[model samples]
Each structure stands twice: as C-alpha cells, then as structure tokens.
Target: MEALEARVEALCEQGNALADLEDHAGALGRFEQALALLPEPQDSHPSTLWVCVAIGDMLFLLERYPEAREFLRRAVALPDGLGNPFIHLRLGQCAFELGDKRRAGDELARAFMGAGDEIFDGEDAKYLQFVRSILLPAQDA
Candidate 1:
C-alpha cells in the first residue's frame, strides 16, 4: 500500500466495521471523508476504487439508488473495478430499482459470470431470479 493508502485503508476499515454493524449511514460518512483525502482526479488514486465501492454500497443499502449508481459508475472507471463482482451486482441492483431492466440484466449477468451464484446468496432472491430469466432462456435455446 502507498503512504496515503494506509491512511485511507484505516478509514475504510472503520467504515467496514460500521457497515458490519448495519450503521450504513455512518459508514458512508467515513468513506466520503476518506475519498476527500485524495488529490484532484480521484480516479488516479488506487484507494479511490474501493472507497467509491464502499460509499456506493452504503448508498445502495440506504435505498439511495441514484447516488449509489453514480458512485458505483465512478468505481467502474477505476482500476480493477470492472472486474469486481460486487460492483457489478450493486450496479445491477441499482438499475433494477431504478427500473432499467436492460442494464440490470446486463450487469447482473456480469456479476453472476464473474463470481458465480454465491455472490447472490445474501442478496435478494428477486435479483437472481431476474438474471435467470434472462440467462436461462438463452441456455435453453
């Protein structure tokens, strides 16, 4: 980890702890604080990806789908972001909640393909069901 990464990681750890305790609002605040530490063009920082993901996840938990989508999309632009299943899953969920079924199906499929069904274990069944509705039919064909 880089010098600032250690500091941001510390804050992220605290945010993770708060998130684990279901204090998503507090976690979001901590993540935002950590993100603010980075220089201009935050995407250049390695820590930006996870911080954005954490903030987006918190926003998702809070049912702030639009804000969640914005942050998650930002993460997707960062390093290794596109390959992270959790990011895809949340983006899918946000799209679903936002009534964008096309994007939901596309993103959910990416999540499922990236990490398998286990990623969907703790998530709402409806999400997996929606993904299946799109994927299973293709398999059948």
Candidate 2:
C-alpha cells in the first residue's frame, strides 16, 4: 500500500511536470493513472482534490470548459481547509469560459478574498483587477 501511494505521488509529479511543459494529453494520462491507483474516497489515502484540480486545469487549457468546470467544482467542494485559492481561480476561469458570468464573478471574488498576500502578487493582482472591473461589472449589468 505504501509503495502504491508512493507511485501515485510520483505519477502526480510527472503529470504536473507534463502540464508545465504544455503537454496536456500526457499530463492527463498521468493524472488519470494516479487517480486510478488510489483507493475509493471512503478508504484512507491522500485526498484526490489536488489531482482533480490538476485535471481540471489541463481541461481548462484544452478549452473543454464544461468538463473543466465539473472537475474544478468537485475540487472546490472537497473538505474544508483543503481548498486552495488557485483552484478557485481556475474554476472561475472555467466558468467564465462556459458563459456562466455570475458564477465566474463569485468564484473569482472568493479567490481574491481567500488568496493570501504571498500568493496574490504582481500579475495576479492585475488579474484580480481585471476580473473585478470587467467580469463583475458585466455580470451586474
């Protein structure tokens, strides 16, 4: 079981590396493999939220907006204290792409609110401003 867990972790790392390289198909394959190796949710093991988030991110990059939104929603709905602001940001992006402007705005707002100063720097600040000025107003109007 320990070895299986280690292999799953290694595969997740490989998937992330492939994502960084923009090889979406390869990344998805690795992530799927990792997911398959893990026990069911009720069994004791590492949470699959991170893997789901990674898969959602790859789907977003591939412009599969609906699938991305589904996966990201699951990631965000995971147990409290396990959620990441970055996952919220990705979900916002997916929602925006899917033409769910209201949800997009709400998700982005949550992301901005939850992200610590350490994470929301420079370009992220610019993105937050853009979301607030453009997306939020569009939703309201």
Clashes (backbone N, CA, C under 3 Å), per candidate, total 0, 0
Candidate 1: residue pairs that collide: none
- Residue 85 miss distance in model 1 (angstroms): 1.1
Query: Model 2 over residues 1-141: C-alpha lDDT tens digits?
Result: 889879989999999899889899899889888878888762234457777888887888888889888888877777642347788788777777677878877777677777743444633355466566754465533
Q: Pick by lDDT: which candidate is best?
A: 1
What's the TM-score of each model vs. the native? Answer: 0.93, 0.80
Query: Model 2: runs farther than 4 Å from truth?
Result: 42-44, 81-83, 116-130, 134-141
Give the distance in Å from residue 34's predicted Cα in candidate 2 to where it truly belongs.
0.5
TM-score of 2: 0.80
